[model samples]
Target: MRGTIQNRDEFLSKVAGQLGQRSFTEGVERPKWKYQPQHAVLKDAGSDELLEILKMQCTKIHTDFFVSGKSGLMETLKTVVSNYGGGPILTWKDSRFDTIGLTPLFKQIWPEENVEINEWESSRGEENIELAEKANVGITISDITLAESGTAVLFSSKDRGRTVSFLPAKSVILIPKSTIVPRMTQATKIMREKVKNGEHVASCINFITGPSNSADIESRLVVGVHGPTKATYIVIEDL
Candidate 1:
């Protein structure tokens, strides 16, 4: 016969101690992937081809375009946005990107928008949600991302919040085309590797395909949920 445990702390501590024993720590000092790198097969197009796609997608004439914390995005976005009458460009000062000295690059492109930086980040939830909902464009970075599927992976946590990507009407993504894999199978393999390496996985992983859409209510296609309606991926060349 076993005695009943009355103290909650003792029970929790016993369980936690047992669980901590199998804590993963081996092979925790490597990039998420080593053996099978993502396969990025470029689909070459004419010089104006990219522009034509943008037009066909109905990119707004004077709309905000969110820029993610990715390599080459700063320079490319400056060139691209300047050509199209730049609007708001979004970014995070996360260590993952800033440690690589990418923050300064972003500062160079469209510095005017920084006039209200503190106000933007410190805004209340209702205001933030409203901004996300009303804004026409958004951008995001990726981790353990996929290019073949034209998908961008974003983990909403801490400073890198979810509303930045979801509430917007249209969202754009910047990904290193080299990180594009052929299938989900390969993607998961890399994820497993990251875990084995003792990397801290994000609390929430957002796999954005094209954009936010639904066919609810008599099959009437409706874009924009509590999320974006149109989403596009601008695959950046691997440096």
Candidate 2:
């Protein structure tokens, strides 16, 4: 056994020697252009144009998109819940929801006996994960929306746990139109700025393009294997 272990060690050392130290240290060079051809076109687009592009790309990626004003948001959310057969919902404890008065709407739509609405709480560590796993739908607020890729950016923190977006079978994101950006570059810049300003940045930043899907097993496409099977984006125009 000792002889075999030594031989294996010798083989690994030889392989590492051949690769050399520089091979691991040297990183790939970044692209020179600020934006690629596809992304460049969206750089100067107006809010309306960006929204249109976001809608088109989201549709292509099989994500349901809905638009609603501040006044109509409650009805829109009710419709979404009703369409999903009124299951348990997990949501973030963000101020944005309070600003729009979502708590009352939730109470009105989903009564105590009918549906369970689990608002994220930091104190409930393992309990939160358990709730998220059982939750039929997870609802969150998107900090940034990449219009070019139709991606929603979520920064996981105490108020907004990562499990709410990942463990559920379906997800609903409440996105403000003002948070929509053209590309990832703009999003990263904002994140960097927050870090520089000594803000409480989250440990995990999730960039969700659409529903979780994989074609790994026999090349047959499967959805919701690792995450939500369906994702809905509610873009609030008045926010």
Candidate 3:
């Protein structure tokens, strides 16, 4: 049996020799495909029109969309928290949130209560993860939102961890109207520029379209199996 198997070595060697002699393309330039601009439809669309389209698309996918101005942002956030039944909220510690002055509002709502409010900290990774797992609501600020698909783009980093959006039962995202684009190509172009400028882009860039849903078992739908069951987007109109 050993001698018979060894006989196949010659055949394997012949195959290898034949493969080695094959010529492969070298430095061959292929013509690139040309297509119409993807976001041309949005070029003439006003901000109000874009916002309406985004809101419609987001609602179609079961995401609650709230519109507010810079002055009304805190009030909108408070209303969102109250609607979610308040307390046990997890959020990122990014300065954009600080500029929005959420800390005082959170403290006012859940003052001195242990485990009621947890902010992402670079030094307290394990604690933050535990808080995220148990939190009723998680809040994040999105880098961009795509109007065509109603998708929000989040870039995770030390300031904003991935679990803050994925581990909670309900997730809330704050997006500026100025950052809303017509399609994904524009959003990705902006992200590419950020990466090129030596910004600290994280290994994970999340593009969340809607709540986590699965229809794999028995054609019945289940929500929040892998992530948040519900998502709410607050679009700041006057940012």
lDDT of each: 0.52, 0.85, 0.83
Residue-level lDDT tens digits of model 2 in 1-239: 12334576567667778888333334757569774675565678899999999999998778899999999998898888778766788888787787876878665557654677878889977888888999989999899999989999999888899889989889899899999999898898799899989997777999998899888758878878899999899999986
122-190 per-residue lDDT for model 1 (tens digits): 335566555555554555666544433445577666566676677655565655444555445557777
Q: After TM-score superposition, what is the CA distance of residue 224 in candidate 2 from its true location, in Å? A: 1.2
Can you write out model 3's per-residue Cα lDDT over 1-239, one digit (the tens) per residue?
A: 12335656567667767888533335746576586577576877777888888999987778998998888888898788778877689989888876766666666656654437878998996888998999889999888888888998998988788999989989999998887888887887797888889876667899988788778758877778899888899998765
lDDT of 2: 0.85
- Candidates arranged by TM-score, highest first: 2, 3, 1
User: Which candidate comes out best when scored by lDDT?
Assistant: 2
lDDT of 2 at 31: 64
**What's each prediction's TM-score?**
0.56, 0.81, 0.81
Clash pairs, candidate 3, are: none
| Cα-based lDDT at residue 119, candidate 2 | 84
- RMSD of each candidate? 10.1, 6.9, 8.3
The candidate, 1 or 3, that scores higher on lDDT is 3
Question: What is the clash tally of candidate 3?
Answer: 0
